[model samples]
Target: MTEGTDRPRIIEYAGNGFVITWEPARCRHAAECVRGLPTVFDNTRRPWIVTDGATVDEVVTVVDRCPSYALGYRTADGRWRSAPAGA
Candidate 1:
């Protein structure tokens, strides 16, 4: 189950032009991220998230599918992005 009341653990992976953020405590492990973008969200990897594994557009699209808001992103330009409301 996800942490509903506590602050989540946030991890970041920076790539050439974007950064990916992961909130472990909030992850449901439903594999939406993995299914959507395996190359970047492979749990078998040490760090799990390889921001450079895919293009920025690919990363953003996959992250938007995260049902728990456990995944997020920021561009090199410093624009923060996240799954849409009610997602």
Candidate 2:
């Protein structure tokens, strides 16, 4: 959960060109992220979401396929895209 709130936890992982956010509570384990880009979404690794593993465009493409909207991203250019409510 988020600090001082009952909302499910949303973790952020930042890289040089983008920032990725993940809401575990919203994940359906669709595997879109892992299958689309294993280097970036490897659950076997600690702090699994590694934004730097791929380019901003590549990351955004995969994140857009997340069926549950558990994955989201913000680009360095100030464009924000995330869960429906968060977006």
Candidate 3:
């Protein structure tokens, strides 16, 4: 926990299109992230998500591939979004 145990910044975007959340830790190295959008979710990287690495559109495209709720997205104005069920 070198960066501090408080938790990495969990980005939850409730936008005109979707309500999405991401928990980078529970990701389980599925690589769904990096595979879907290499520019944003690179394996040979730190701060792996690199949300800034891609545009919000690109990020959402990749995040949608996550099998775990480690990444999630849905219609924004339809249902309220949440962070990792219990989290």
Question: Which candidate has the top score in lDDT?
Answer: 2
lDDT of 1 by residue, 2-84 (tens): 76885447888888799898878779999999999898888898878876659888888888888888889998666677645
TM-score per candidate, chains pooled: 0.78, 0.85, 0.53
Evaluation by lDDT, superior candidate among 1 and 2: 2
Error of 2 at 31 (Å): 0.6
Best-fitting candidate, measured by TM-score?
2
Number of clashes found in candidate 2: 0
Error at 80, model 3, angstroms: 8.1
What is model 1's C-alpha RMSD?
5.3
lDDT of each: 0.82, 0.86, 0.61
**Superposed Cα deviation of residue 50, candidate 3 (Å):** 1.5
Error of 3 at 45 (Å): 1.1
> In model 1, what are the clashing residue pairs, if there are any?
none
